[model samples]
Target: MRLDLPCLGVFFLSVIPVNASIRERLSYQGLFGCVHSGLLDHTGCHHFLRTDSGMEKTKSLIARIQFGKFFAILQSYANKDHFNYVQFSNQAVKMNQDFLEIKRLVESIPEHDDLASELSFPSHMFQLMAHSATFLKDTSNDKSRGHLSVYHLIDLSVRILALHNVRGVLDSTNSISEEKIISLHRELRELVSTFVHDGDSESIMNWMFQDLAIQAEQDLQKLWQQVSVHGIACLSKTDQQKCIQLP
Candidate 1:
């Protein structure tokens, strides 16, 4: 049987893993760093931090530069008033260089703890957000050229991360406009909605708990609504009208 949003929420919300404050025990950076904590048990990060491989760091930097080049070409045809998904698909590649840089950065552990922590956020974000491809993109199908796909969201996420310093709505940036922010939020919901039509219940459920809502950090919009806390009021037909007062 197919589970809709409300059923999925109810089915999983109560069972939402508790005990360790994922927020406290596993911070975004901590999780990604293989803190024994998470970001896949914090294993992969050690190599990146400890490696003497200047070659790896050089590769990551080159990937970032390449992304900026591609993105600049994309921006030229953005057509702000109305998004051009076709033009975008024409440009958006399945595997982005931005993600490649992120992956490379995470793999090479630097000597300084502070530096590793600093790179943690983007690396962590990449870990959490990179899989939109599984549910959001289908290379064999015409899905990539569809209205929305993994390529679009990854590009958007990377751009916002760059423009906003990975702060999303938390920090202010003169470079990105109010319209851009609004559009980004809308795109997030649109991407999320697509999840319903794509992946199976188990996989989607895992992502919700592990990445999107994971306390282990790298959650794109931690500062956004506490859907878990407010699900009751939001769902209650009688109570839905009132404001949700967080305790």
Candidate 2:
């Protein structure tokens, strides 16, 4: 969704579930029980942040995959058959060297003043979100609402990165076809329609989570402001109307 949307001119506002709870609402401790930012770049973690002004890939090619160690945690679980959200998230937090490596790589990068911070995920924390989301997705445990809260975190992270990918395209691109826009919207809506969440918010974890979670939401608000700007100036009058209606 992130990689493809910029080329099509930010196609999936429809990815947002029309539901009120989804409309309403993630961080490190705010992270899943065991999740952390681990980029699945074009090479791995959810396509590592594209560094070029949130624009689409200029050239397309698939990276070779070796099924990195992160994959091992998925199958190597102690329980094998079932685990709760805590069990799931902490699975990586254990003696997994790859998880540690991914965290180090994601968090070690200092912020670049040259880039628009709003159009980026802080410390690439989205990798954690993606990692946790992937893990949560594979597990069979939907036991309590905790899974939904974790998903809420993932969904929030996806939007933040999605905005990053779509940053400048609406103002700069004229090639995006109306048909492409409509098709992408329909495809996205169909995909979104299946989402179901039932829960009150989960309690905040440690101070680390609290700090990161606050920053993430603050960052999203800033990006929404940017989107609102483009929406008001949108080329098509109907598109402008949709922009004005953005939550």
In terms of lDDT, the poorest run of 10 residues in model 2 is 58-67
TM per model?
A: 0.31, 0.33
Q: Give each model's clash number.
A: 9, 14
Quote the positional error of residue 152 for candidate 1 in Å. 4.4
Instruction: Tell me model 2's lDDT, rounded to 2 decimals.
Output: 0.34
lDDT tens digits, residue span 93-205, model 2: 44244434433543443432232322234334534644554555564355454444454443443333343334433344233423233333333322232232112233322
- Cα deviation of 58 in candidate 2 (Å)? 6.3
What lDDT is reached at residue 146 by model 1? 34
Top TM-score prediction, candidate number = 2
Q: Pick the candidate with the highest lDDT.
A: 1
